[model samples]
Target: MTPTIRGFEHHRVPVDGDVSLHVAVGGSGSPIVLLHGFPQTHLMWRHVAADLAAGHTVICPDLRGYGASDKPAEAGPGTYSKRTMAADVVALARALGHERFALAGHDRGALVALRAALDHPAAVGHLACLDVLPTLDMWDVMHGVDAAVGFHLYLMAQPPGLPERMIAASADAFFGHFLDRWAADPAAIPADVRSAYLRACAAAVPSIVADYRASAGIDVEHDRADRTAGNRLRMPVTVVQQDWGAALGFDAASIWRAWAPDLRHTLTGHGHFMAEEAPAMIAEELRALLTR
Candidate 1:
């Protein structure tokens, strides 16, 4: 009972050194790549990818350290930097014959998409980010109440071996915590999919932590350099997010506006896994962004 995207053809693509991604391709028009968030695979795009596939060539990939993709041995800075991961996404699209493609990401995947747009503006026709802020803004917005909500980010950002050991001890509980707590309706994630996510995470404790650790260190430095140079997303950008500003007492839109000069920001009461919790809306917003 392996998870499969109906009607989509799957392929393994080599992007970086010994790191290959599992990508699902469907449809036959312009290309649109979808990146999934943490503790989930490209399966997160099951609904949206199918919808977008009706009129576009939708590409969904299990990002480097997650899903059926290669985890790779932890190698410090460059191992799972979003910049490197973002380049993987761009290279993946190009290898598939798309010179430029519409891009969308959820959670961690959103961070990668943001980086891709900044690092290779000419390659991204349009961008959509579901339920996440830029990495730098994400760290800066954390304070009292919100910090409590982001405890895992701090925990996973710890030195290697330590975080991996702790997470491995209670893998299911640790991975399942966010899947249950962050969703408006936990049932939105089918039981089998939930089990699949937990299993993938439990098996790759070190690489998963390395992915987060890069964000705490190198990812931030990369972001700082971009900000210093006044780099902004020149492509049309659309963001869909749960109202973290309302709950956490920070201005979410203003923070995102600083990075996306051409922006469409939508505040939703939908859950953090918005693609699953609200597919039609997510699909509509993404289509709207490309039409611009």
Candidate 2:
């Protein structure tokens, strides 16, 4: 039977000046902040969060510029940087009365989680990243055949005004293409959920493009500076991903090891949206990570 995620209470809390997040909170125990990836919202964690809430308090938030969160126009380089997004997570957790909490992020949220660990090592007690590599390695690994796997990366990585304009022109087709192509089982996401995602992305075009553009520019500089400073994720880290790196001629674990000393890496058969495609397995992996 498909699970139900109806009881959780939704909230809109201020993070930084003029920016707030629509968050869902449920269960009660040690805190675990669940960060959703791009083209998705906190609803991505519905199944997983419901399970984890049995033994933990789960806080799932819509990242800025996505879902019901504030979609303010980009205010400068600092506004959409992962560093700033990470700080928003910190503030959200603190606002919820969690001084330190375990954090897990999928896709784009994984990037934010990495930044959170580096920027606020004392706050994120345990870290889990699903289906992504460090930004620098990600850029270095994309070429030739593997390049096709992340067409959106290049598309959204384009300089400012142009990409945003093009994407806005064909919003549904651009976003729907990823929805159809990436899912191992399209039926897994019901039409309502899919429509919700499309509408959210469509409405947040400028901010969404700016977020990706920042990754191609300032986010890369942030990652390179961290590497130069020898900054690493201080918490125990668990990574679950499909073997994209091996298929693309890069050692995924080795790349992650450079950033996280205590790491557990697993290759799953699920597609890019592992949390939704294989929630039970993802939940088990998360449970084990928390225990360790």
Candidate 3:
């Protein structure tokens, strides 16, 4: 069953080559696209989207290989690159008559938002990232002991076949691990929502792993290239994350500042799933971003 998202109107919109994203659109006014992270679908934005919809046209979509969206076969490298996913979002917004829009993303989705803002500077009005770092910084911050905290990163970073097979063998338990640990309060994600996430992730193991695979490989290359080219998000960017850098022995703000000049760097105690755990707070942060 498709989990309902209150007042959202669902659509299967074409993005590119036989790929049509399952998008949930609501409200009116300036458009704001919301992208969900790993192990969850567009449903992750239920509260945030609904709240934002009161004053913005909220566009929520199950990213390329997630949720009810089309999961194309893992054809090759860069297939699930954030660049392609970002392009898919740009197209989705343009299709909805939004030449430019505010964008916010969490976890994996934040990576997409980062890439979108960097790649399509003019098309993104504001960019908000929740609980994540750029791909290169993510790898840099995970040295030695701290790497253990992101064991999934190493697992998915492995070359193809093994990661897919291993994750498949224990999909629920593996996916459920984050759904359990990443949230400050597990109850933030209702039981039904958790079940739906596990089910969707388990069923799309290949595509899901591919999404992570791209991150470990091509995404890092892209980030590196952007750094070499002195490219950064030219729009207003807000980053809200738990101060994991202090724990990981890395400088989060400095790293983010290098990429976002006009940046609102927030160090939140909220968990990784902040959008779900604290919708009102997330909505408020987004409002601040839009107003900037």
Best by lDDT: 3
Residue-by-residue lDDT tens digits, candidate 2, 1-292: 2223566888999999999999999999999999998888888898899999999999999898888899888878778899999999999999999999999999989999999999999999999999999888899998997688788888888877888989999999998888888788787778878888888889988988878888888999999999999998888999999898667888999999999999999988788888888899999998999888
Query: TM-score of every model?
Result: 0.98, 0.97, 0.98
Give the range of the ten consecutive residues with the poorest summed lDDT in model 2: 1-10
**291: Cα error in model 2, Å:** 1.1
Report per-prediction Cα RMSD to one decimal: 0.9, 2.0, 0.9
Global lDDT of each candidate: 0.91, 0.89, 0.91
In model 1, the worst 10-residue window by lDDT is 138-147
Instruction: Name the runs in model 3 displaced over 4 angstroms.
Output: none
Ranking by TM-score: 1, 3, 2
lDDT of 3 at 103: 93
Q: List the residue pairs that clash in candidate 3.
A: none
Q: lDDT for model 3, please.
A: 0.91
How far residue 230's Cα lies from its native spot in candidate 1, in Å, is: 0.5
**lDDT of each residue in 230-264, candidate 3, tens digit only:** 99888999999999978888878899999999999
